[model samples]
Target: MVNKLVFLILSTVILVGNQSFAQKKITLKEAFKDKFLIGVAVNRSQINQSNQEETKLITSQFNALTAENDMKWMYIHPKEDTFNFEQADKLVELAKANDMFVVGHTLVWHSQLAPWVFKTDKGDTINNAELTSRLKKHISTIVEKYKGKIDAWDVVNEALAEDGSYRKSPFYTIGGESFIENAFRFAHTADPEAELYYNDYNLINAEKRDGAIRIINNLKSKNIKIDGVGIQAHWSLEEPTIEEIETAIKMYSETGVKVMFTELDISVLPSPWNSPTADVSVSFENNPTMNPYPNGLPDSVQTQLAKRYAAIFELFNKHADKIGRVTFWGLHDGLSWKNNFPIRGRTDYTLLFDRAMEPKKAFNAVIDTVND
Candidate 1:
């Protein structure tokens, strides 16, 4: 009887240990496999597979990959006649190897665009014809190169202002609204099979949401192949209420295209403006108060972050049919762009994984939203 009791205790201990181990194996991609594609924007280090730990985390946890900066115009097509395919090729190759869905970050954007694209050799802004030729060539070359490998392309990014008007970017100035229309057309011609999307930030605002819808309507009117709209979800702890997000998702889907939370990262820091903005050009002088959690996020704030992520995921799950994909901007907190955006050199804990690459409370909270 004594031996049997001891055996029973050991069996219970082993069973509980196995259960814990099994629980840990549930990855983000697996948890949301039926909902949407789990994705992360990967940088050069990860694309090159230099950091084995991060690469492993990426392949195991996420099923979709977006090249953070490598595929952007400045990096991919820096000159009128020159095209750089080194890094972009590696990123596509890595994604293919992992059986991951690849996103070509952007084909046209005002920011990070090469000056040569709009200027003549003599330093004058090129004519509309020249600009159109350059835009077509740039989009065609890149899109056709990875036609089938790249699952989607952010055809035009941040082309509208916060108030719902077209941003007077050089693209708009030179080519008018036809610039956006032409971009989608050019990409579609290059790879009719690949999905093309218009990506923007601050889309939760009512006016901006209407602006995105207008773009979708215009594209569909012309029979352009615009597959989705990417709302950059660079949100904060308590702004752009959950209702606003759900409404935006529903509205975008109603336009006959899918919705995507393309670049998601919930910042725990204070906003510099009245509302959340992912305008990379915006910056503020760093102050101690703004960088409140320099040492590390306190437990209270961490709990808040967890709950915030949970609420957001719950909404995503609620409308999973509308959302085609949800991608985090980076893999871990240490690599998050929030650390330098708006205020440079500020330590901000803004990702599901902490600096050590360990899954934080927010990560577990996101998983529980589905599992529970």
Candidate 2:
């Protein structure tokens, strides 16, 4: 019966390999229970509860939900007066049903904005006074409607340039730097209990970090209630070193404001400009060389990704007291913006979960870091 014994042995080995790192009783939310909440961005599909498999993972591993696009200006308020709360309401209800914290993505941003936001009925650019009034009314309507339901909000997003200079966004050009604090003021008026945050990418860069801190300090000086800062931790494998991130964490912590590692994802693809900034407008022509791992991530690159996540989690654990939450940009790599961002049709494996909703090695590495 030598063949029988070999079959038994082979079956045992295969089973063990598959079960070793598969989903278990252990979950990311449970792992980081002692620290901050684990969060993920939910698309409209997730909001409708259509994807049971994805929802199962999200419910088990995450305790915070950020609407991927439902709460944006373009979707929430397509017209100046028309406010649609259909999907937005569903998102909040989903979070409440799951007993998860809810965060409103953004109140003001330059991108994905309606043309009417910057123009009048006559197709003319609105003046500063009219624009400020519009901003106040918009923030008030959304924030007040979900006052107690939404716990936090990205009060203002992407306001600082990478070089620490104020970007010439429409808000800045019309209302000037005063728009930043004014937005915070309007949100506070809507819901004083709601925690407000300013979120942006490239936060690890020293210049941008300083600019953010200056804004936060100025808000506090004006007696405006600014609660936290969201550092969109969209990083790559090699750059920003662990040291740079650690330094930023400490500096933001020093501001006496909670630091959130928002939009946390590590890209495994080649950089288009070798920059750390996250600009959806930036794009390039398709190049297979940029997407070398079209078939899939090699085992070696997977290990590197795992190692990178583990290291970052280790740092987060060290500063768990200062941090508020760590959120993945999306649930799975297949749905990650990186897959279609910068260049369309690129197979980028840049998230903790694979295309099949299976937890990749990086997931385990992060769990291990918090467990330790």
Best by TM-score: 1
Report lDDT (Cα) of residue 189, candidate 1. Answer: 95
lDDT of 1 by residue, 204-315 (tens): 9999999999999999998988999999999999988999999998899999899999999999999889899988888999999899989999999999999999999999
Off by over 4 Å in 1: 1-22
**CA-lDDT, candidates in order:** 0.92, 0.90
Off by over 4 Å in 2: 1-24
The count of residue-pair clashes in candidate 1 stands at 0
Per-residue C-alpha lDDT of model 2 across residues 172-257, encoded as one tens digit per residue:
99999999989999999999999999999898999998999999899988899988999998889987799999999899888889
lDDT of 1 at 287: 95
TM-score of each: 0.95, 0.93
Which whole-number lDDT from 0 to 100 does residue 370 have in model 1?
81
Model 2: what TM-score? 0.93
Candidate 2 contains a number of clashing pairs equal to: 0
